[model samples]
Target chain A: MSLSLNQWTTRRWSVAEAVDGCVRHGLQAVGLWRQNVAEQGLAESVKLVREAGLRVSSLCRGGFLTTGSAESLDDNRRAVDEAAELEAACLVLVVGGLPGVTPGEPLGSFSRDLGGARERVAESLAVLAPYAGERGVKLAIEPLHPMYCADRAVVSTLGQALDIAERLPAEQVGVVVDTFHVWWDPQVFEQIARAGERVFSYQVCDYLHPLPADVLLGRGMMGDGVIDFAPITRAVLAAGYAGDVEVEIFNADVWAADPDEVVATMKERYASVCGF
Target chain B: MSLSLNQWTTRRWSVAEAVDGCVRHGLQAVGLWRQNVAEQGLAESVKLVREAGLRVSSLCRGGFLTTGSAESLDDNRRAVDEAAELEAACLVLVVGGLPGVTPGEPLGSFSRDLGGARERVAESLAVLAPYAGERGVKLAIEPLHPMYCADRAVVSTLGQALDIAERLPAEQVGVVVDTFHVWWDPQVFEQIARAGERVFSYQVCDYLHPLPADVLLGRGMMGDGVIDFAPITRAVLAAGYAGDVEVEIFNADVWAADPDEVVATMKERYASVCGF
Candidate 1:
């Protein structure tokens, strides 16, 4: 396995630039976000990466099932199509949060219906899994940190993600083991083991507290935060997951740096900690 | 069951003032913090609450076992003694996080030896449990939010806390069901049932994101955040927790308010949602 530069790590870079940066860093793959693909035109983005001989490790995201909205489902279907078109490893699903919330929305708007929202995720997965499977695209449920449980993703644990995924076939639905989201969990390794072959993607990033005003962008570059990546990487490898290790940081400082410099830092950090 | 106004909610208020505030709000109990108790002189703090006809629901905190330091054990024993002296229901334990780590410590300083830290907590508990029981105090393990798992507490779930608690007698070691900490857990309701009579304390505080710089003080007043209190309160009650429902907000705004007003808000908030 080799390092895959997740495009969000350098938020400013275009798909074309990100693929070029991956090439420059000798990275074998690049994880593309849907937004960047859209900005460059999907077919052109696919052509650019394919022509550069860079594999699409995974697609950034495709789930917000809690809204119970038609738009969310339609958007997800389009994301699945994009993943299939790009021949990405899987379509990563953030799996939506509380139905009525927007980021920084007032407390009054919070439904506090966590279980209801979770049920919607399972229901939505039931609907989307078959579609993705038919298109030969895997839906990788990324269980984000519990801090994002309210407004970002209701699926807050890999165990919980697997519980949903196990309902569908392993090839159709799987879990993303993102170090930043799960490093705090006491049962993380156990859950990682339990995920087994259903482990679809392995994303790396570090977690730093005293988080900035936008908590979403608080992911630190690997080796810049407390996560011991060696152990987590070892666990994923032990669980029989042989895939690209995508560095998916969302820090503002990292994003502000030159794209080439960002990729260089990611490569250095990834090599130092992940041993891939 | 009635409400207990946790002293940290009105952080600036002295123990004497807090007891008076609780009384003014028609509250029968106040959860005392060790620092506040120490500031007032422990004996004097005990007398103040007793004289005001206020029961000491629980002591604020008593665990930092992750340090694997002798001082941590000594401090926890002291906390047990203090709880016993006040005849508090239980000594709330925020069982510490990773060893050799300080808040905002460099990422390199983090041991990521979570298992080792957790082992130390169990070892520390084994040492302190008998002492606490002998002193007529119950040590309540309060599993904090997972976000704090890195630098604050390794015990991040009620199931994990209960796993530790079950190793000892129920009367000697019980679990705290704090809504803010355990609400996001998918198995929380099941764990609450498993806790049964071992539920020594049930703390209530709402959770809101866009947390302040110090995430520690981000707890919102009940009814002001996203937690559905009624269900959690109901779960604890069903688990045979016939104790005070402590309102333990830690917001800077709440602390900045007049003690009387803060207590008033807590009472109103508790009554509106906690069903006590």
Candidate 2:
């Protein structure tokens, strides 16, 4: 039940700072974000985390295939290369939403083709899966919350992500089970059991109520929201996910807190509340 | 293909005003909320709509069964009585979210028993369905969006709603297929087809992105957001739903506009974009 601190939980911290924070907190693993890795340079980030003796549990993201854009696919290939270079557990994918809708744009000017967007994700995976396998990286498709289906990932359920994953090479493609996104799902437990051995990463966070203005940042620290983590954590363990559980909160208040305090709280909550 | 205007679409309008607006717009049906019926006095509100030649498409809501409280059961009984008196096509049920979590409370202080809350909804339905059945009122379960799963409705998918609905008498219990709440569901079409004759109401609205500060009011007028209404509308129709399609927008901008103008836009959208 090793705890992994996802960098986004302490959003202001650099890769070097996150690595140091993990070491200071006696955490054995840290999840890396592409933005943070780029800031410190990928080679330098790898060296820093390795020297600090922290396992790279997962890479933040690498999918937006809904656009069917050449650039998106090319970028995903680069992300796979990065994940391989860092020797991370998996490259977590936040597949894109609708094709034409940018945030804050007039609502009328967007595609109404959700089916088309989802189809592209499956097709893009066919291309990325083997490439990732060749580089010894697993592409973990993360099913985001349905609230994000419009502006973020079209993959909105563990079952839906698994449906796509089962069609590809098992060693190359799988799903990330994030509690905050899939906790509300009626079929969650069944899906988790079905995702056995295909569970590439297990991410934890609580789904807070009275969601903030930006729902994207609505995740709260465990025990600070309505989610029951024990049952879900046990389900993930039952699914044979013998990997680090990453705590990935996207709260504005959390981002503003001292990174050290955040990591400390995460560790305490993980041990006490999350049934490891 | 007949269109119905849900009262909340014109939040500022009185029952009398809503009835008149429906009549003036050549709309034959109007959905009534309990608050508005109470505001105008139930008998008077019924008389007003009946005299205006407007059919009562459905009562706005009648379920908060998750609390398992005697008071909630009593209130639902009264709501059923109100719908029976008005001769609504059905009484829409927005089954309650988690118990004991008021909006804006400290995030840490809330129940984590989603399964228990949902069970209470089923148990309450067993009590209410027979009561509504004797009164010739159908209990229509409305599965709201997963985003609202914490504070609004725990029933967040058409399939989940059907699972509950199937346990009761088919003629007495059914489900409302609301576009805004269910459009993001990958299994929407399959669930809609399975809903079949159990489809009590067909609610239409667009799910706007860059959701407003209050996600509750983030609905948009048809064609103003990313929803493709034609396919969903067709699925409902194909499933043997022959009821009036209710235009139920909960947008702040729409609320602030002139009620008459809002009705006009609703009519135009229902005709052109909704594929009714």
Candidate 3:
């Protein structure tokens, strides 16, 4: 089993440091994000990743469906272009939520039109699908956890993601089965099975106790929470996916620790827990 | 159009006091929890409810399948007996989770094979179903939000609840479609439509801020969160459900305030938002 280091694992590290860190850790594959691509410039970021002898497993994200604008649409399409240039495996989509304010107040009118958000997301996906297909960079729709339904992505379940995937004509439009987002679902294994070849990437993660409102940074290290990763990984593999089980944790505590230590510990823990 | 005051609306009050308060506020029906019955004793509680000319829409609970001891089974069967005694319209089931603590921290086990928890719940349901049938109480399977998957009920989605309902030999087992838990679902209408006569009771609620682990007591009031309650109520009514649109708000903030004020505001909001 190979390991893919999501740049988010070392979120504190710069793009250059992130590439160097992944390489130093002997991680052969790395997923780069749009912000870093912008900072380092697409060509140099691509060059840096190549020099580090790392394969781009996936590009971090593209679609944020709710807060749609000409600028956001153009930016997402540009993200697809960058992924193609980097020759990444898939462009992971975050798929946005409500129109504004990032859902700070729980009581705000944060867009209850799930159908409207879903429609906008689907429309944006259609716009990006042709570009993704032409560039040979797959688009993996990452269904985020339900906690983020108001601000992050409205796609909270795998079956819902598959429903979206099935409607799209793009052969490259697949689903990213992140354990952190989907492990709570009773339909998880069944949906993973239904995903079949459409299963693009598996993001292994866990949740922490005393959940915080800013869930973006609260993700647990594998084996830290209740997820039975081994059984889930077995299901993913059994579904005909041969991709690297990408360890994508967003814990502030883990990130606050030294990057080298985090990477070393993550590798050992991933193999030990995942039985790699 | 009618207003039902769930006894939980005046949880801190005596059953008679709650009913009196509801009557004072022109609220028609009240859903009672097992605890309320325990506090007043069932006979007195029912006497109080009936003498007040109040409707008992549902008995707040029944199926807690987490327990396997013969004593626990007997206790739940007793809850059904009480529901029957009260002439309750339905028995809401927050089907149980992990059986016991794993002894590590002398604390709860977060990962006790949820599928196992589910089976235990189903088994408990099997044991309790016949008793419920004879008692003339309808069992409404309340699928708690996924956040409660570890500590509370393992039934987290309408789909899972409906699957269980479908497997049962009798139509006695159905579901409680609460907006608090399922409003974010992509297939809300689809599942509601499938629920048919099986949707026993519907709770119209809105989520407040992420509750502090200590303050799970206070949920959000209606129209105070991201829920678009209008169309959903329309859909549930459209699905041929003429049962009480029970307002079950577990909000500490509202609870901390005067129960009288809470009831009045909830009545106004429910009328304006759901037009009940």
**TM-score of chain B taken alone, every candidate:** 0.96, 0.98, 0.92
> Per-candidate RMSD vs. true structure?
1.5, 1.3, 2.5
TM-score of chain A of 2: 0.98
- Candidate 2, residues A1-276, lDDT tens digits: the string is 689999999999999999999999899999999989999999999999889989999998899899778899999999999999999999999998898777565555567789999999999999889999999999999999998898889999998999999999889999999999999999999999999989999999998887888888889999878788888998999988899999999999998998889998998888888874
Residue runs of model 1 more than 4 Å from their true location after superposition:
A108-110, B104-110
Per-prediction TM-score to the true structure, in the order listed? 0.97, 0.98, 0.94
DockQ of 2: 0.68
Q: B86-204, model 3: which lDDT tens digit per residue?
A: 88888888886555523123335454476887877777777777778877878889998776665667888998898887766445788999887897788888899988889888887
Docking class of 1: medium
Across B65-165, the per-residue lDDT of candidate 2 in tens digits comes to 89889999999999999999999999999998898776555555557899999999999999989999999999999999998888879999999999999
Which pairs clash inside model 1?
none
Ranking by TM-score: 2, 1, 3
Per-residue CA lDDT of model 1 for A1-276, tens digit only, reads 788989888888899988888888898999999989999999999899999999899998899899667788899999999999999999999987786777776644557788999998998889899999999999999999998888889999999999999999999999999998999887899999999999999999988754666778779987766677888899999999999989888888987788888888778877787773
